[model samples]
Target: MATALSEEELDNEDYYSLLNVRREASSEELKAAYRRLCMLYHPDKHRDPELKSQAERLFNLVHQAYEVLSDPQTRAIYDIYGKRGLEMEGWEVVERRRTPAEIREEFERLQREREERRLQQRTNPKFSSRGIRPGLTTVLARNLDKNTVGYLQWRWGIQSAMNTSIVRDTKTSHFTVALQLGIPHSFALISYQHKFQDDDQTRVKGSLKAGFFGTVVEYGAERKISRHSVLGAAVSVGVPQGVSLKVKLNRASQTYFFPIHLTDQLLPSAMFYATVGPLVVYFAMHRLIIKPYLRAQKEKELEKQRESAATDVLQKKQEAESAVRLMQESVRRIIEAEESRMGLIIVNAWYGKFVNDKSRKSEKVKVIDVTVPLQCLVKDSKLILTEASKAGLPGFYDPCVGEEKNLKVLYQFRGVLHQVMVLDSEALRIPKQSHRIDTDG
Candidate 1:
């Protein structure tokens, strides 16, 4: 390779290759390689003009490499998220970083999240209510398996109603058997819906129905207008009632429809109604009333449970602290040995209640600092915990007693600062980039 890097290679940003060391190389190893390269490439050692220029270029490249890789924090940041991470605004919270695989995964993850937010913007749902009319309706559904589902709906009001349906989904088709209530509508019906195309851009479906709604058949399709809107059309050809065309416009969770009956002359009829189901009401109720009530009720129940288990929890917490005190001496020995070499180190750790939880609703979140215990648990720079509940681990206790528990850890592995939060029931394996904290080093 030439002493002077080409524009393309500079853009490629493969500094480790120029340094002649592996990505996982130790800092001391990298320092040694940098020194050797500098000694061989120093401009002052060259005699001829061309050699001096080449040596100058080589020495400059070597110096840049040393500047980047010599510092532990900068090197870790560069190794994980790349140079862009070093320049990004608010890099203190740049979503996440991984083991030198951040850019593609981060871009893809953000794209998916943005698409979901555009499509599922239901914070203010425009619910379509099909005229509730002071009636009581109950619905129950069960998923039989991956491909089959059954439903039962019962409504009592001016007219009694009971309906049952069993639906099965195949690769590109859906089959449904329905049992309706009234005379002609009471007949058993089988319906089939075939999807011609279903993807991000377009969704096309053709359906055939019998029994409750006569021998009706229709084909409908929805096409993406943009991230937040969709346009749809459906054409139906029935027996005596003739043919109909429906045009639909969908914006987020809200949908508008215009239905027209096609006469013999192929013109539209005056029977167009643009009303949607009253689903927004339920969403509003859930957001405005239901969630707060449920949360308050949960807190009340949790308080009662905690009060009942107060004494036991206190005893367990004392025991955990005692266990942590006993572990400090051995943990210091382990940390000293770990520091001598480059490996994983427990910078901070806590168990029981979550340390990162920012909820202000509860004043007391009982977490035991288990940094010593965790350091003792680390073997050969790797920390592994069994699949069983971590509450049973040494130096751990049920901080919230009757509530869910989490273990929060902040650790440095080979110089990279990483943080993770794990549920009590989850197994733990340290130094995985998937659990890396979204913070600047």
Candidate 2:
């Protein structure tokens, strides 16, 4: 049965009814609806080349709507406020068109700012973003003739990333390197730090040798945790490797200082926290933006290395075509396997969050991205459905507990029509439920 259209959908027309779903539907209902419509309207499943683009646009809209409304909170906000809530919340929503002149001006301004920061650091070394006098600061004092003498050593190891704190009161170059020296027995340490490449991302940093000759390095990745906030984690190594950890917390803020605009600052009360098993500690706040473009460049170089491997293999005089093929296949598998090792969303993503702490949540996401291989999609849906129905065939699980769900399979079974849904926890198999599906040209 077709669902009723809401007031907003009625006014918008244009398949808007097909996009927004009823808020009261269960998770399974929503998923079923999405999977059904996606397969039915998928442009790739159609042959009329002219209709392909139009179908693609509609598919994208439906997919986007499902992504938002499938989540409870986002659906509520959209229902009450429509697109306005998304805009105010900094969502990746469409914006009003900007004039050509305005667009050019914005780009120019960004370029100028980048150049200015680069020049400023070169000329005035001490003018750090964190507002600290660069260079070394030390003190030598004697106790009131107490038959002993005392001295103090204080050094501000300012380089780049650390030169500016999150407080906006400082200016940072890209990275920061620092070293300190005081009393040989106690005051000596070395430290290094860097921030994330993206502003809406997390900051990573580390410090070690602590007093004058310690080494520290850290890496951080950003993820959206909730509507109003973002979260991330970092791994580090150094002199204080197991002892010291830096916590960076940043928040967004906007004010009417001049023309309307948006900006973010490190909250004054922002807490810097770190824990060593049972211990917990906190410090005051600060801010800065790290760049990731450099990392992408390095990855490109790695790609070149992979491409060059085949040439190296070919150089062997005894090499055979079979050996070359085997090497290539092995390399492909290695690259895919590495995804699970790095805990990223690529090769091993189908394993459902192998490295994630929350297994259930990750598994649900992974299921959505597992497209049926093209070979299966070209056959009969009934056979595919029956095969997918096997319960203990491995790789299948009730990822979302308490929900009666089915895998809306779309694949080939014996070179015939294949599109079906099945419920099999051990092996999600699908069988043709109706004769409506068409898997031919």
Candidate 3:
């Protein structure tokens, strides 16, 4: 089992490379990978006692990496800042309150813990928990489709509430029942009933119904096309409401036509020839009511557009303010950088593992080191790697952008290893290692 560490502690790069797979790997693939690494690095495989210890150490590190990346929420955090980003809260919270040094410290602490476990795995394989559990759902429904005249729906799910209604009009009274099973990825249900009005005073009349009423099925999908934006599609059937309007926007582009009626009857026998769905409004006279309503609708649409634009403007303003604040924080960190001149230099690096057994008979070990520098590194009280080094380092690439970073550091100050986690832009000085009387020393 991997111990829990707050977002305030962990190394970002070790978090990413720790898993030994690309960021785009699927959840299942990630599991397979963890399993494979555990098998390969299990301490039992090492022939030499010392090598066995190394294998055990790396195994635990591998286990910790899998424990994090296997979980969706934790993986998201790791994806952002490698192992270090886990110190910060989940995706929604950014640690603007912490200093750069503080964030770095958090990341460093996580990194050290991971490394320590990596060292420990050499002899023992603690494969108790990988930090993943299966999630499930169930649904029941009948008459979920839509008809030209109106709607029919049925659905049931545990995550939703049940609803029932009865109404009595001048002509008839009927009961309606509805249930929504889940939120978003859940199930749904609906039911309908009908009863005739008094039959003694009028011509013969009957009511007929087969299933529920007014239910539509919908789903949304998204694909990323660029850095700052994404492509998405919404599919649905039924009455328009809430997110259902997304489908209406696509339907609006189609052509429309209505059927002609010549006979007098309570219900028209006319058909519609619209590209999408039918429009029931009839005649130039009916256009009168529709005209005013259309005008009012246009006004409403304009009002909505105005409101949306205002909201967009407000959102942009807020974003701009946040950007400015970050810039200020960056400047402050730079100023503070002058003090922690010789701190631990953290670098994010990436390298592709290549199996080049050219001999085809003997195993080979080849590790190409790639250093990625996005932030400055503190080493021995002097800034060795400046931010400018970021531009020159290969593979110092950031696996995730638009994510907060927290860093923790654990190292021996005198003779004992201590841990410190920091949020991005936060700072911490390593406590001086205490010297104790040692016969060996």
* Model 2 lDDT, full chain set: 0.37
For model 2 the TM-score comes to 0.21
Per-residue lDDT of candidate 1, residues 78-114 (tens digit): 7665666566676556434343345455656786566
Q: What are the lDDT figures for the candidates, one per model?
A: 0.63, 0.37, 0.37
Q: How far is each candidate from the true structure, as Cα RMSD in Å?
A: 23.5, 24.2, 26.7
Q: Ten-residue segment with the worst summed lDDT in candidate 1?
A: 270-279
Over 1-441, each residue of candidate 2 has an lDDT whose tens digit, in order, gives 112223342122122234323345567866866775576457786556645654565568668777766765555545545645545644333223443344455557776666545444432223222565455544433332212222333444553222211111123223333232223322223333344445444344343334344444444343332224444444344443332333333345421111111112222221123223112211111211122443454456545543444343233212222122222333354435434343111111121222246566555543432332211121222222222222111112222222234555443323344454444333332333362255354
TM-score of 3: 0.21
lDDT of 3 by residue, 1-441 (tens): 112223332212354343334556678867866775566567776566755665666677668877887776566555446555566555344344444455566667787566444433321211111353323323222222211111222223432322222222122322233333233332233322233343212121122222234335433333222222233333333422211213121123442232222222222121112211222223342367644665575566545554445544354334323222223333346435534553333222222222345643321111122221112222343222211212112123221122233333433322344444443333334443432224455
The global Cα lDDT (0 to 1) of model 3 is 0.37
TM-score of 1: 0.37
Candidate 1 ranges with C-alpha deviation above 4 Å: 1-186, 191-277, 325-329, 332-347, 352-364, 386-389, 401-406, 410-441
